[model samples]
Target: MLDPRFLTIPITHRGLHAPGVPENSLAAARAAIEAGYGIECDIQPGPDGEPLVFHDYQLHRLTGAQGFIAATDAATLAGLRLLGTDEPVPTLRQFLDLIAGRVPLLIEIKDQDGACGPNVGTLPARVAEALAGYDGPVAVMSFNPHMIAAFREAAPHVPVGLTTCAFGEDDWARVPPARRDELAAIADYDAVGASFISHDKDDLDNPRVDALRAAGAGILSWTIRSLAEEQAARRIAQNVTFEGYRAAY
Candidate 1:
């Protein structure tokens, strides 16, 4: 369970998108706010260096467009419609404006390594600028520890969370088993330095979660879709990520 002292809840993944609402679009965020749920969405830099809300490396999956999100400018992305909706790919600022202090926001920085890498250079600063003076609670989350570190430096007041996923046997097969603990320890340490840890549901059972909580770090779990998973997450975390089930408590 989340610490009763802090204002928090199970944030909706990509803002409560369902059969009607498009994931990561402004409409989805609006739906989340209308349902009184906190919003969690992804941020990536467009080719023109603007911050846009999107989750995938390529636009083809969500939008019918080819190439990566970073390959296009905001104007081009704005022209493309999101799947199942007429909503254009909205900028992070636009999404925030749509929410309009109705709910808190959890912004995730999506960075898959490549020529585009993560939006490391100016992304943090832009996000900070957009969030400046906003009254609602806001926390920045990222899979990349460096991005969290940069956010910490750029916006000291805004809380940051580190997102991690457990490795499977196939993952272990690629990397030596001996080094996994060392890497996990490093990530745990980094997460501790940040204000919170946003990990998968299974991570709640890990000793590191207790260790971080003991140190006063906030804990959050991601992408929970079932009642059983939500119950499990409630038992172990301060918050859980949600989608599809709007009426769920």
Candidate 2:
């Protein structure tokens, strides 16, 4: 269940990246808040191991740049402009400063491959440090179970969410049912410590949702783009993290 202390509509994906808004930019976050939406942004560690807000493994999609985020430093990232704005890539700390206390921040940590990987080793600590004194609801999420586990140990007080795609017995037919149950159990353990479960909207009816909710996890669905998907999510999720749509309800 969602902590009663936190607002119900905590935030939306990429902080309202619409036609005119640049995804993951402070300008976009501010726009979302101004229009009464909380903010959700992606966090990844740069080459220097600083937590920065970016979505893709490479910068080509958002910026015309041509390298992986992990290969660049903050200074270099700050030099290139995001596609739609003069604004450069904003560090997680800079993003927090912009949205501090104004609205809740949902930080989605990207997977940097494996346990003890350079990106995983340093980013979580930096994110925890950046949010040390912020007086608002802060949550961390990741598609990587190991990374989520690390966050649970590193920042216990700050809620964490386990992100999953829509895969089930039918999807994973080759895998043994026992293994699937074990994976689900691991996710439940993280959800028990997490604020919510952020998942792909299409997975609403997946058994994992029932399992996680039964274990007392709150539901948050992501990148909702259409009215039908949005309405479907409302029935299952406590909050919807979106990209194109500004108004959730």
Candidate 3:
């Protein structure tokens, strides 16, 4: 089941990021807690199967580094600084310890297959192990349904969901057209046992989302940047994953 707190709490995308406090950093997580907002973060397995709190598969944009996150070892990742900040990337465990259940957490596990297809790697078990004893209001989701299925098998008790979108060609050049269309229809919702969906704020009007909402599924929206956007997204979504500004609900 989807966690009820995720529905009621206002979520901060990437942990209330701001100047000098980069997204997914421990500093950002602390900022979100101080602001009394739920945290939404992303996770990728380190080189040795440890889960790191990070967003891109690539390291350059956030860290000014040269390679993918899966190629970097735990200690190395801990050493690299976030752009304009001294804060290093944190492990999933460190993030959880800091939060300590003070606020809800939503973790998005980026697709490992690169194609968002069936070739999911060992991330499922690694992530499941990380969440094994950590008590918090947390949910896991991905744009790839296959990853969600694998994760569900590994951690059945955790609420799992899909990160939905209209999958515009320009925006999703990595995901093939066929897969994009296939996922856009949301055909895997039941087969993968998803209890919720964090859809693109622009596409919440889709019939599939409405159908699921009518059937009692949890509906969340992503990247709401302002109070106006949050207000509009609340019409369809029970909550929002937001950034660039505080959501004043």
The RMSD of every model to the true structure, in order and in angstroms, is 3.4, 3.6, 1.3
Q: Whole-model lDDT for model 2 versus the true structure?
A: 0.73
Which consecutive 10 residues in model 2 have the weakest lDDT in total? Answer: 1-10
Clashing pairs in 2: 1-216
lDDT by residue (1-249, candidate 2, tens digit) is 344423376466788776656889888888877877778888878888878898888988888988898897667787888885787788888888888777777888887763212345767777787878877767887765667777767777887777666436775555456655655444455443665777778767877677767766787787687777777887877677776655443
Better of 2 and 3 by TM-score: 3
lDDT: the better of candidates 2 and 3: 3
Q: List the residue pairs that clash in candidate 1.
A: 2-238
After superposing candidate 1 on the true structure, give the runs of residues whose Cα lies further than 4 Å from its correct spot. 1-7, 112-119, 167-183, 186-192
**Pairs of colliding residues, candidate 3:** none
CA lDDT, every prediction? 0.73, 0.73, 0.90
Highest-scoring model, lDDT: 3
Q: What's the TM-score of every candidate structure?
A: 0.86, 0.85, 0.96
Instruction: Kindly provide the TM-score of model 2 when superposed on the true structure, using C-alpha atoms.
Output: 0.85
Which candidate leads in TM-score? 3
Per-residue lDDT of model 3, residues 1-249, tens digit only: 987988988899989898889999999999999989999999988888788899998999999988998998767777899986899889899999999989999989888887788878888778888899888888899999999999999999999999998888887788889888988888889998999999999998999999999999999999898889899999999999999976765
